[model samples]
Target: MSARLARARRLGALLLLAGTVQATPVHASADQPEFTVTGAPADRRDVITWGASADRMSNAVADRGYRLVVHTSVAGRDLRVRLSNAFGDRPVTFDSVYAGIQKAGAELVHGSNRPLTFDGARSVTVPAGGAVLTDPLPGRIPAATDLVVSIHSPDAAGPATGHWMAMQTSYATQGDHTAEEGADQWTEVLGSWFYLDAVTVRPLAGTGAVVALGDSITDGWQSSSDLNRRWPDYLARRLHAADADVQGVANEGISGNKILADGGGQSALKRLQRDVLSQSGVRTVFFFEGVNDIKAHTGVTAQDLIAGYRQVVERVHAAGKCVVGATVGPYKGWSEWDAAGEQVRQEVNAFIRDSGEFDAVTDLDHILRSPYDPERMLPALDSGDHLHPNDKGMQAMADAVDLNSLDCDSRSRTG
Candidate 1:
């Protein structure tokens, strides 16, 4: 089975393992750090280098430390990480947090590990459903480096919030060893991203970011794990080497997420503000979703899905940001696919290509579908299930995107 398909199934029972500790999200006391978000300035250059969307974690833990390794998309300085508790029923208090450059398994590059502060405080407490963006650390973070974030919470218990199906390797421990730069103490390998969701950096004044908003494909299910082969990762590399103003990339794809309703995660319509709009220095939204809704045989018409896409475009426009829509690719062999679903997919693709409602469009369906059978994915690009793409397909999708369209008229409302 492809990792893409397994990831979707993993979501159903994630809580079984993480189903441990924590109470409702809580506000910080005078001495306790609070969850506070000071959005990046409009005139400056703060861009997201790495991102993992938040989802409900049925499990919680106390006195546990996490060593999360994420690949940076854009090179910049003043690194910051946003810790999330967006799904916790109880408050979470992170007693220690550190960031560094990874050397070997669980080991940090010498002299790179540094402590992080939330508004000058060493510790922070996120409310039942809130997040805290850390004060920027002074230093330049190189693009494409394996950035590791170490975290420890003394009293995390209850339903927690985090990202499942990370498609990357992270580490965890039973105690607060966040300050250590060695690997001995961090032995447990974890697949999910806990607490932290977004990382940002300040690059050249004019440089910005493009957020790839979608499902498993964008999340990089079939792509090589721990190697950052997602379509967005490829896009980031392209942006970096090119002479474009948009250099940042955030993958906000959830495994089973849909555009119209909640299931895999919050519906795209629901998460746009928090995931897409809130990211620092985002210039365009690369919208690619709706396959889940279409395949489920829920009686969702192409018109219904189109309406959902329109809603997203309108909301993003209202925020003054540009949106680039991508045509949904073929998924003829997946279990739920039927004649009715194929028709819906065709109509949706037609609208994506012909409709000018989006600021711009990328014909992903055209690029990924088999010419001989438009309803089926090309064998070479298909990840076997016919719904998700392989590494080559991901690269094709990223390469298909026009670099100029990402800026959306010289970045109208982008941060």
Candidate 2:
């Protein structure tokens, strides 16, 4: 059998492993992560990269039968799975990966006998330099399902595949004082060079998290890797401190996504369902996009861009979820940015600030614009490109968010 088929067959054996077939569809304890990967530098179709890791940390935990961290507090129900090879030269293989519940802080806890499968099979092999989707392994998880997924090499191979989602420096061992000496950084390459996409604990009962979607600015470009200082990461920390029931932030931002057209990725319209709507227990979405669209490739008009935002808002609201809009930051120095684009950006920002269509809105333009010269870019936030926000800038962006508008305490009416 082909590696992909072998992986598929392995998944078929999940039921034979010993465990009681408990009545399923019970709530998962927390939210699962929303992970996806695609190529960058706008318009490269054949060469693919994934959101993965270079070190085998996640692989070790999954292989040694360590429980996924999210299970400690996930809502049980139909859970979502996203396996990727957003950056790989060969087919990526996954062995037996399972998700379930365990006691809080249990590192080695393996919950239930349930395993992840794709298309009714056991193992799965993502195409060389491509991405794949897994079928939902339903009913196996309950409230607080502790996930333990084991990935073995079809042959010997590395774990992560794409650009590292870095904010601050990360250590190989969680809670260990040892530094992640000589670890790879994102700017060194464009894609995940073997990294963990993300892990989401299912929402407990009725709670989930909102994934802030966008580009490198959202990804925290130039932020200290593993510092957990990305705006989204910071927002997560703030939410946790507030004793809010938020599970965690699943950042799907790719570093160059535009709202209306495919540049760094399939346009917002193309990825909305997969990146935003499909998140488990998602009750709200904060839309922070369009800067690249208005200033970069698309050169879309202010009215057209506003219309695009409107479409996104409509779609989210149709799903019974709240939406928040973020104004685009100044990009006076972006390679493609010019006076004309700045004018359009100004128009769009005015609309975002004045528009009541969003459940809530944030003035990122106001926060990121240069105080010295309103038309000029903020030197601190500029990534030298005068386009993407630097670390402090991303943090500022994160700080700018009005968390209250997310409405975490409110219940979602799901279809």
Candidate 3:
């Protein structure tokens, strides 16, 4: 055979072999193990918990609608629904909770939703400071389903705890937007409510979770709920859009969570395992906590706060996972307003901006703080509380973090 002909035949043979390999699915990929927990597989225990003062009340609208949108890739069979009232003073009574496939930026239809049951019947009550796992009989989630969970309150809940992350401003199908509407029960109509607790769709085995840990700012206080304005939520949206290789975010920012001692619900140190390290598929953590520690207590200097930060970093690192530190933003005339505290905050901020201990640094403080008044927060950014940034401000903070920087994938041991 001619030399050219022989080489051509060899190349063709190699191409054929590559095609066969690509066509054949590996057994390991086909039969990967699904996540199994202490609860029943048929039951949906999707609500992840954190927070303080379940008793603290905020007036939400009556008969309002709340919806949770999640984009999931399901490789497992037999899917179900899960809901949460993880932080409640009294029993969190669900007037109605339903789940079903949904369209992008739309309300769930009544006929499409399946009624969820706890134990074996309609309506389950989750006690204060505890959660209930519900049966999956209500819904059958298809593979890679975008599940929408719509729920409403049976009674008034003061201070309806929420981590709002609506990308565009979420609208109330009816009525003016106010804190009072948050207390109102959500009807079965196609209206959007605020706050998304948890959404678990089957993930391909080995899909890692990116846990965004922070304070009320991270908790998304004023970001119009349903609009998906919260930075973390925006990050999730961005990740989904980019078709990134990681699972979506598991946001554990309680309105008042601090890094030092217990404040908002449980301090960052206290809730690390439950919120970040303990999460299934969690391989990376983005830490934006510690403002509360500075704002809540005056005795601790910025140096003290930095020490607390080091401790947090040490704990996170010891777990063999990656930790990204976000600098504390400018807060003026807010809680614990003191020149000394501000000075301390600046010192701590400098450390965060320059810290080499962290696997990555997200300069959120520099992104949102006022340029004219370096100490004072930007008017547009500050929520009326001054300490917490408004929705737009939160978006800027989220924008500041370079998602590309969190390239390391390190899983931590579950304690």
Which candidate leads the pack in lDDT?
A: 1
Evaluation by TM-score, superior candidate among 1 and 3: 1
Consecutive 10-residue window with the lowest summed lDDT within model 1: 14-23
Model 1, 1-415: lDDT tens digits are 2542443244223212111111223333232223334322222346788888888886788898999999998888999888888778888899899999999889999999999998788988877767777878999999899999999999999987788989999999999999999999999998999988888887765566788899988999889898888999999999888846677898999999999878998888777766776677776789999899998878899999999888888777765678999999898888888998888988998898889989999999999999999889999998888899999999999999999898554234334
Q: Model 3 reaches what TM-score against the true structure?
A: 0.64
Q: Candidate 3: which stretches are off by over 4 Å? A: 1-37, 41-97, 101-107, 115-197, 204-206, 333-336, 378-386, 411-415
Number of the candidate with higher lDDT, 2 or 3: 3
TM-scores for candidates 1 onward, in order:
0.89, 0.62, 0.64
Model 3, 151-245: lDDT tens digits are: 56556364554433322223333332122213233233332224334444333333334678877677677777555466676676655554444
lDDT of 2 by residue, 1-415 (tens): 1542443344232212111111122122122222233211111000001111211223322232112232223333344344545344456666544443333232233334356565666666765434444444456243323343323334324444433444422122222111111222111222232323433332333234566877777766766653545677667666555544443455667666778876575577766754565444455677888877876645589999999888888777766667888988877756677788888988988888888888788888888889997765689777687767677887788778776776432223234
Tell me the lDDT of model 1 at 372: 99
**Candidate numbers, best lDDT first, in rank order:** 1, 3, 2
Q: Rate the local accuracy (lDDT) of all candidates.
A: 0.81, 0.52, 0.54
